[model samples]
Target: MQNSFVKVPLWLFERVVGFLLALPIPIYSSAVYGLVTNMRGLPHMLGMYIRGLYYRQKLGLMEPNVFIDQGVFFAYPQGVELKEFSYIDKNVLVMSKTAKVGRRVHIAPRVFISGGGDFEIENYACIATNSNIITSTEVLKDGARCSGPMVSADQRRVFRGKVLIKKDAFIGANATLLPGVTIETGAVVGAGVTAAKSTEPWGVYVGERAQRVGTRDSVLCPDN
Candidate 1:
């Protein structure tokens, strides 16, 4: 099937809208942030839609049904994609261009996802509040290097890889998913865990360096 959305490049926006637009973007974002942070209920929902409309026009691809809550900041939204029915909660910072959120996905408040590589959250996936997902990291190759748009070009070398969260996966609160890791379908990543490796489908993982404690089916049918 043909892709339904467009991924606008950062350069393209600059070229089309000119550099003047850059100066006011942060200010506009801040105003929206403030507005969203202060309001709640119907007012907050209205603000979300308003901001979402502006973002969809300025950024690359944001589907019509997507809901972007207040205080959500994106450094480079050009490469981002928010599929249908997905909602981003408050105070989320997405600093990467390669972030893709799938349908019906719920990203709770204070979630931070960053890096230059692909960060994909599949349909029906939920990432709890304060979760950190990194798909890009700085390494000392020729010297200390950083990978991202905001960093100086020569100062740091940034390495990027794909971080995949498959369908039906549940990443608990404050969990950290590192670069190149995959949380497979129906997998449960326990709270406060740091996942450094790929997980098995339907597995239940916990701890700092997450280890499989059980399967999802076992959790659902404990008597079996």
Candidate 2:
């Protein structure tokens, strides 16, 4: 039961938003996207709902009942896939060519997901606010690097890998998951941790370079 203040059908509105979302990425990724969705009250609600519906149609995959919040900054979203009951919070920047987001996933506000390769997030995963999942890094040749769109070919480098998060994983706020790392099922990353490797299943990890501390099942099933 979607409550709408406006007369337009949700589907119709979705289609309209889809059209806007399909505009050339590099140009309208920020401005038009923000302009349409940054309003308050009914307009904001409408914007959020319409954006979700629009992405569902335009993206590689998107399931039902997904709430995409206002001001979600998605770059190259054509290859991103989202599953059922997933919620992407406001102002989260997902810059991925092929990112697979799974069922019941909740991405908190201002998370940065940058994937040049395939980044896969499994079911029941929560990415907390200000976390970063980076699947690629710049490869500098001869100590040369490119800052903007204009740079010599020799200064350009794009190294890519996959980031895998198993089911029931929680990425803490401001955590950084580096390229080619996997967070196993039921693993908990403490806030401000920077994980550079795969976590043990159900393990609690914390610190700048995260290490396993305890098993999640101990707390989850205390009597067991």
Candidate 3:
């Protein structure tokens, strides 16, 4: 009699679980993953799987085998395309429009990228922690009245420019790549540097304003 009672509850529990599992992934994806984009504290493997589905179906364009870690936030994911084999570390924020993260790109933790359409990180690029890639900003020069997003459209004079991290480029921690600048293929932006202009291919930049301190040997960047 005791064995029969135990089997009854187990059977009911299995049926309930089966019913839940029968539901579409979209419903679960939206209900849970949509509401909690970060999904922090979830198992790493599970979070990656759920986020992969969410990105492909609802969030934005993500190629196969992309690893998007927890705590990442996309302010404008509709216009972003995450390329194949890319990895985004935790807590990174991408606020760009029409941004393309190229193949095998690895973005480290707490990096912030914001710009308009045409912003891109080319294949094999690595962005270190806390880097800021600001591709567009208000024209706050020569006593101009136009400035910032808060002002009216007519009053706002935007300084829009394209920022690109080319193939095999490496941006160091706390570095800031300014509007309209491109870190060319194999270039390295050193830690704490502020890049104000485009870098030459294979150059290594350092200091307050981008200065080519040396050249990164192309041999190390074999695929570049």
Instruction: Residues 22-45, candidate 3: write the lDDT tens digits.
Output: 346767845664444666523458
Clashing pairs in 1: 145-156, 145-157, 146-156, 146-157
Model 2 shows how many backbone clashes? 0
**Candidate 3 TM-score to native:** 0.80
Q: lDDT of all the models against the reference?
A: 0.79, 0.78, 0.79
Question: Scored by Cα lDDT, where does model 3 land?
Answer: 0.79
Top TM-score model? 3
Residue 206 CA displacement from its true place in model 2, Å: 0.7
What would the per-residue lDDT of candidate 2 be over residues 1-224, giving only the tens digit for each residue? 45665545766776776787767688676565566556342335777665765576567788877777777766776787888888888788888678788888999989988857677888888999999998887766667685633676567776788888888899999999988899998899999999988999899999887977888872353311
Off by over 4 Å in 2: 1-34, 40-44, 139-151, 218-224
lDDT of 1 by residue, 1-224 (tens): 13334345643553454333233566775665466444452344667645654666656788867887777777777888889888888788887667889988999999998757788999888999999999888776776645555778778777788999998899999999988899999899999999989999999999887989998862342211
Please report, as a residue range, the 10-residue window in candidate 2 with the lowest summed lDDT.
215-224
